[model samples]
Target: MKALVTVMPKAGVLDPQGKAIGHALSSLGFAGVADVRAGKVIELELAETDPAKAKAAAEEMARKLLANTVIESFRVEVV
Candidate 1:
């Protein structure tokens, strides 16, 4: 099985990197941009064959180490 993990900062958290990217986009002539959020994607290959198991394992991994639970949120997609 293949899993994709997306980690992003929770709402209300200050995102300096996202702000910088938004500013740069406006400066580069992409106008009307209101906000931007930066996040990371992780791809994983697992031996589990069931989609449910793969998703559960990936979510556990995110909770344990992949994401900082206090300030960040994670979504897992099993493929």
Candidate 2:
């Protein structure tokens, strides 16, 4: 089984790295960029094949180590 984990900042949190990237893009001649936010995508291969089990385990992983629940939110997709 393959799992994709996406971790993103909470709506109200400020993303400095994202802001920096936006500024860099504008400097390089990209226009009309209003805002930018950054997030992380993690791909994992799992031995489990059942979708329910994979989803449960992925959620656990996100809660335990993959994401910070206080400042970030995550979604898990199994393929």
Alpha-carbon runs more than 4 Å astray in model 2: none
Candidate 2 residue lDDT tens string, 1-59:
98898999999999999999999999999999999999998888899999889988998
Most accurate candidate by TM-score: 1
Global lDDT of each candidate: 0.96, 0.93
In model 2, the Cα lDDT at residue 20 comes to 99
Q: Each candidate's TM vs. the true structure?
A: 0.97, 0.96
Worst 10 residues of 2 by lDDT: 51-60
lDDT string, candidate 1, 1-79, tens digits: 9999999999999999999999999999999999999999999999999999999999999999999989999999998
